[model samples]
Target: MRKNTIRPTDIKLHQKSRVLEVAFEDGSRFSLPCEYLRVYSPSAEVRGHGPGQEVLQVGKENVNITNIEPVGTYAVCLHFDDGHSTGIYSWDWLYHLGTDFDELWAQYLERLEKAGHKRKPAPAAG
Candidate 1:
């Protein structure tokens, strides 16, 4: 697959909405939910050391990003509220996640279902 030379022009964290809105240099923008980002983190703990050793993340429906630190000029280290901060989200990877949000989220849900795991309940409506 060919990676586009696109780069992020801006990133905004909406704490209230629980989403990260990213705008790319190529004019493409995406709103990625915090839950999605948490579950798909590329950290060693979640990805494990090799194929087939992937760990499934559960009970992260309300997880939030506590911080976003730049990793040099190529990536950003996300500090999730759940105390997860090992994943270095590169620009390319972020773009990929944004663009492929739908399919990837569907796959995640399927995996959760197959494993007999369900997301935690959302907070009650007022």
Candidate 2:
């Protein structure tokens, strides 16, 4: 087996809305929405061992992570106001997310559309 390593080139925080802009040394960058990152989490709550096991996440249109706690030196645990913090996302996972962002995002939109759902922008805080 080959060993894989990833180093984050830069991470930008959108203080106003809680978005994280992550860029890698491989010229891959993605503006990861807080909500999107929360829902598509690799945790068992989102992903499963096989197909048809994925639970379509709902009511997460406005979820935002308030904190990110590191796990060991490879993964990070994201804490959201919605009380979701089970997923430990690794650097390799983050890299894949950033690299396939466009395609993955498009697929998400397509699924939502197929399900007759629409993406509403996150509401402004009062």
Candidate 3:
């Protein structure tokens, strides 16, 4: 389907925590975790200078969405707490993420493990 072909049926903002929930008419509900949104951001800060050069984002579990901007009728730009707002999430990309969520999330976790990175809640109190 085309970008404009599928319009978001519902949109909600979970303010104070910076989350934007978008639901399409196809019964596809995207609860997209906030951290996932930040890490997978399509901006230069995360996408890096070129392919395979993406800087792995860590310790963003508590990072929240600050703002969400609509890009025409095809995409949405996200603003994060770290001030890294540059990526525009196209509808097609968002759809893929919503559809293949499980697989993509697993891949992210695996990559983190391979990199010796841990998604710890926080360092144990002393």
Q: What local distance difference test score does each model get? A: 0.90, 0.79, 0.77
Q: How many residue pairs clash in each candidate?
A: 0, 0, 2
Quote the lDDT for 115 in model 1.
95
Candidate 3 lDDT at 121 equals 81
Q: Mind giving the per-residue lDDT tens digits that candidate 2 earns over 1-126? A: 116857677777674676878887777787898777886788888887678897777667877787888888777888887998988888888887877878888888888888888888777766
Per-residue CA lDDT of candidate 1, range 1-126, in tens? 226557799999998778999999989999999999998898889989999988999999989999999999888999999999999988888988999999999999999999999788867644
Overall local distance difference test of candidate 3: 0.77
Order the numbered candidates by TM-score, best leading: 1, 2, 3
Candidate 1 Cα errors over 4 Å, as ranges: 1-4, 124-126
Residue 11, model 3: lDDT of 69
Quick one: RMSD of model 3?
3.7
Against the hidden reference, what TM-scores do the models get?
Answer: 0.93, 0.84, 0.81
- How much does candidate 3 score in TM-score? 0.81
CA displacement after TM-score superposition, residue 81 of candidate 1 (Å): 0.8
